[model samples]
Target: MRVVMFGYQTWGHRTLQALLDSEHEVVLVVTHPRSDHAYEKIWSDSVADLAEKHGVPVLLRNRPGGVELLGALRDAEPDIIVANNWRTWLPSEIFDLPPHGTLNIHDSLLPTYAGFSPLIWALINGEPEVGVTAHRMDAELDMGDVLLQRSVAVGPHDTATDLFHRTVDLIGPLVTESLDLIASGRAVWTPQDRSRSSFFHKRALEDSRIDWTWPAEDLERFVRAQSDPYPNAFTHHRGERIRILSAAVSEGRYGGTPGRIFIREGEGIVIVTGAGARSGRLPGLVIKRVRTEDGTEHAATDYFRTMGGYLTPRP
Candidate 1:
């Protein structure tokens, strides 16, 4: 099959590599230009770079519009269009151009987590499992019919980055199987249940702010969701910004204001959390590690030298 791929970043790079390794022919590749933003994560194995290495023509466009793009697709005459982590809206002119139609590889199970940072959102929401879904492309975002779905268990200690690596590994197999089904004319299409669907907007630095009012478990998940490669969940302390690297739910029950910093024996600096929805006992979270605005990383004990203050949203 002649595939015209639309993708960007690591997800795109991996998918393109899988397709190239397969019997399918990737005639044309469309990817976004390298972003200069310091916070944004540029792909280590970029789709554009991979395409060039394979001697496939590449187009760097955020939006797949204009006559040049349309003409390129027409000239290539793609049998099917495969998109993975493509950031822009693709008009029907391109998606509907191919004979086998377009297929998209999404990071989450369809009918849920349908937008940006799906793995992060799922982890923050405390989902038991995270999965990837291969589905038919439609005008609506991620509201397509399902072709293939695979899930990975989200362990209690699994961070968003951990889940991300696991999820990406599934993409290649999912894409290959989906394409095989499509080529064999045995592809099954399952319509998504709109009632069960949920969409999330793109995340920003502001979204990573740690809200102390949340339950201890939720806050712990928040920290894990944004750790390392992504922005760490943060809070303000005495006009200083502290990025929470990792945390865990403490076993003790403390009756105090939420977000108040307290030391626990062998547990590090523990912050009181909100009362459980049903348990009524106040929960707490043990801070494992943090990074201060001054760019110093510290263990909780060293960071909160004398901790008796509350962590507030404002300095």
Candidate 2:
């Protein structure tokens, strides 16, 4: 089958590589334009460069249906278009252009965690499982029939960067399997239950803010979800800001005070939260690593010490 692939970032790069290495012919590749340093620099290579290396034509279109982009896509005349986390929406014409219609590879299971930053959102919600789905594209965003789906456990120690990389690695061979099934016309697609569907927006700094009032377990999940590649969960420490990188539910708990910094045990500092103490259990977290707003990374305990002795002093 002749394939045209579209995506950006690490997810897109993996899909492009997979199709190129597969049995199908990739006629052209489409990706978002390099907006600026912020978006472009995160990725080591653009999808265009990879396509060029494989001698497959490449198209960078900020708007998938804009005049030039639409023309280029139509000219490529691919049998299938694989949407691997393509950020923008495609017009009906483009989605319907290819012979086998468009199939999208979403990071999350459809009808749930359907929008952007799915792995981040899953961790933020403290979900035990994270997975991907291949679906048939529709007019609505992520409102498509599911072709195939698989999930992996989100370990207690997992971070957004960890899950993001795992998902990208899974997408490579996993997608090739989907293509093989589709190529053989043995694809069994499933319709998503809209009743269980929820979409999320791209996370912003506001969303990453850690609420002191939230239970320590909730805060811990939030911290882990946003840490590292996804943007660290933040809080104001003695009027100066700090980002929480690695945290986990600690064993000890006293009373119901949230965000009260307790003694550091081993490699972390314990704090309280509701999610941490569910089912009549004492809930809290110990932060391991912390980064200050002033561009310094430090052990959480040491940073607490450097913060004008605020960790002690008693609130």
Candidate 3:
């Protein structure tokens, strides 16, 4: 079967690689242009670069709309259109162009997490599991009929970056199997239940700010969710931005105030959380690693020499 693919970033690169390795013909590939943003991580093997390496036609477009794109697709005459991690809205002119229709590989199980940074949101929200969904493309975002879906456990210590790598591995298998089913004319479509659906907006830097008022467990998850390549969960110390790279829910706690630096020991820096005493024990978060604005990484003990102040939001 001939395929026209639309994708971007690492997720896009993986999907395109899978299609190229499969028994399908990828006639055209559409990818987003290179981003100059400092925060964005550029893939070494981008979709456009991969497509070029494989000798497949490539289009660099943020939005896969307008006449030129349509004309190119019409010429390619693909059997199906496959999209993975494509950010923009694809008009019906493109999604409806192929004979077998368009199939999208979404990071989360459809109808549940229907928006950006789903893996991060799932981890931050303390979900027990995370998965990917291959579905037929529709006008609504991630509301398509499910074709293939697989789930993986979200371990207690798992970060968003960890979940991302795990989820990316599933994409290749799901896409290959979904395409096989479609090619064999045995694909099953399951309509998504609207009642179970929830959509989330794109997360910004503001969303990564650590709120000490939250429960210690929740704050721990928040730290893990945004660690590493993502903007770390951060708070202000004397107007200096300190990004929390790793943290854990401490065993015992005594509450003076939420966000106060209560204990500074060799183990870690324990900050009291808003979850007050329960059964004579208060909740606290033990921050193990941190990074400052100057890009200096440090252990919690070294980072906090004087431990009486609080971790507060910038005013």
Best by lDDT: 1
TM-score (C-alpha) between model 2 and the true structure: 0.89
Q: What is the C-alpha RMSD of each candidate to the true structure, in Å?
A: 1.8, 3.5, 1.8
> In TM-score terms, which candidate is top?
1
lDDT of 1: 0.88
Give the clash count for each candidate: 0, 7, 0
Model 1, residue 61: distance off in Å is: 0.4
* lDDT of each residue in 142-231, candidate 2, tens digit only: 998988888888998788878877777788877899999988999998889999999998766678777655777777778877765556
**Model 3, range 44-158, lDDT digits (tens) per residue?**
3588989999899999997876789899999999999999989888888888889988999999988899988889889989999999999999899889899989999999989
Q: Could you tell which candidate, 1 or 3, scores higher by TM-score? A: 1
lDDT of predicted model 2: 0.78
Q: C-alpha displacement of 157 in model 2, angstroms?
A: 1.3
* Poorly placed runs, candidate 2 (over 4 Å): 36-44, 272-282, 306-315
In model 1, the runs with Cα more than 4 Å from the true position are 37-39, 42-44, 275-280
Q: Residue 114: error of model 2 in Å?
A: 0.2
Ranking of predictions according to lDDT: 1, 3, 2
